[model samples]
Target: MLKGNREQELIELAQKMIQAKSYSGEEKQAAETIGEFCKANGFDDVIYDRYGNVIGIIKGNRPGPKVLFDGHIDTVPVSDESKWTQKPFAGEIVDGKLYGRGTSDMKGAVSAFTAAAKYFAEDTNRDFAGEILIAGVVHEECFEGIAAREISKNFKPDYVIIGEASQLNVKIGQRGRGEIVVETFGKPAHSANPEKGINAVYKMSKVINAIRDLVPTEHPVLGKGILELTDIKSAPYPGASVVPEYCRATYDRRLLVGETKESVIAPIRELLDKLMAEDSELKAKVSYAVGEEMCYTGNKIEGERFFPGWLYDQDEAWVQAVVKELNNAGFNPEITQYNFCTNGSHYAGEAGIKTLGIGPSRENLAHTVDEYIEIEQLTKVCECYYGVMKALLV
Candidate 1:
């Protein structure tokens, strides 16, 4: 239903969004731009929530199922700007691809969704009976699913469409993520008298080594659960002459289906217990990491860094509808799953909502230097989004 010249308009909007710096907790500018676009393009109700999430609503005359198209506006900070061949914020185009920080990770897909929603609003011939909500959420890159969880408190939809980079495939599920902190405690003493104090770093090193050899459970679709050491730090102000009193190592664990927080942490706790029994002085504890962040609106948001994994059966009505829509839009969409976590972890994972993903660009391209999205893929994604709206709402 999206006709001529609209494709260019969508690209322009994506360019504008990419031009803005929306790193993690700072998405106010991108949210405002998206809100203005929604209002200018005939969205029925456009408003910003207390946490700075922008939601555009289009209500129908009759009662029907509520459908949400969700996309996060925030992106990870650009590391090593000198590594990028193109300007990270310029929204440059080369060889039919648009280059920028958020192009593939997601601003391009968000723009496509906005364009499709505008098209649906402008057309007088089609009368949809269900409500359509397009949300440009915030803080997803820093804290996955926190903003989405907040949004669901107000707008709980029957179905959700996540606009994460899927290479235009239909993603039915993803592995969950958990941030775990392994802390080792010891007494501080002079560095020269090492035997007087237990070295917490040495105890932490053993735990890290043990975790590296862990064989996580594997699923047929979601693949294997993985544990990787992401960060390590020791306390005591850099330790000039004193032995470090505390050492903490952060582990990122990918959870398979049926793996709960308790189940995920059981192995690490067992390892700690074994080590403590071997040496009473080695005091180590394992606990889930807690995250605290402030939104651009100055609202404080906090949650445990545990995202449950989720999956929807291919035979489900929503999955079938998305498949039909993608085919109708002239795309050969393969059924797939996300390798990384997204807001789906909250919507479908925690809330048990029926959810699927379809968007432009490859999933692997996210967070890489010189990130870009193909223009053709962007246009196709717009058509696919419109097709989905028609399949579910009309």
Candidate 2:
């Protein structure tokens, strides 16, 4: 259980994080604060990766499996401050809730694991085995698994715990997210003589209709792999008396297990090919969207938007071990899965490591007007993380 002073420390750490306001690609202040906390605590060493990820290493006296507590430090921007009852960056505590921008989305989880690692290391005095690595990952809001690739390469942890919002439920899997781009091409001509030009918008319409007809794949547990048209734009903003010659559309794809990049676009490409065969003038292309962002450390991080989905059977040994310990610790966490994508997409979906997401708040609270996390949830999750370490760091 979390004690009074430890709980107070955890609350203060989360407050400082909320006050820092670290948006995507701008997490230096929050990162520095986390690093300072790790150093002031019992962490043996703290290092910033090339991408400005703050990693705190607490090694036990004996060697065993490496357990990583992963949480992203960046957050979505607060679009309107006036609409929020609580200031987004103030980190105010009201009626047992700590209000701020990144509290629920994830700075609260980061602070939990940070304080948990400190308490665990001090309580054991490094008498246990294995390693406890608490990482403050960056750029997760922009690229789900890109920076995590760096962390995996650096630590090669035996297991990963993603501190995504799970409302204290034990998440075993998720339907990953992918951004698919489709474009159409045609010849431009004067609107006065529209028949002389092939309107790209018309060409794109055919593709959109075909996509609408495509069936979404289904999973027994993770639900269907749904695809929806999100954005579409033509080359010319204002027709300008000319027929538009190019159209681009982006689709949000919810990925399921066993779906790959080639598999995802294959059906769309087949439809495009069939359309092209019927009409020789029709031209288009489809591919995954590539994302590139500048990190706060002045480093560049980029990746394809095809974050893979993953799942684990509830009967897996580690899964049961964690459930047993958390249950024994007075946390009745249900064995479940996240409804949205998370950093687990990289660790479990891409890197093929066993992963679990167990965090402190509701997912819907993220990116809202007045985002906040309960102090009770924060302290409970700190104890929960410690329980995970005790269960796995054998």
- The Cα local distance difference test for each model comes to 0.88, 0.92
User: What is the C-alpha lDDT profile of model 1 across 1-394, one tens digit per residue?
Assistant: 3456897799899999999899877999999889999988778889799879999988876779888999999999998999999999999999999999999989999999988888875673437788889999998887788889878889889889999988888999999999999999988899999999888898888878888877888899998888888999997868898888899999898988778899999998998899889988989999999989888899987889999898888888768877887787688898888889999999988898888999898887889999999998898888888888888887
lDDT of 2 by residue, 300-388 (tens): 99899989999999999999999999998998999899998888999999999999999999999998988889988898898899899
Best TM-score goes to which candidate?
A: 2
Top candidate when judged by lDDT against the true structure = 2
In model 1, which regions exceed 4 Å deviation?
A: 1-3, 124-126
Q: Between which residue pairs do clashes occur in model 2?
A: none
lDDT of 1: 0.88
lDDT of predicted model 2: 0.92
Q: Which window of ten consecutive residues has the lowest lDDT sum in model 2?
A: 1-10
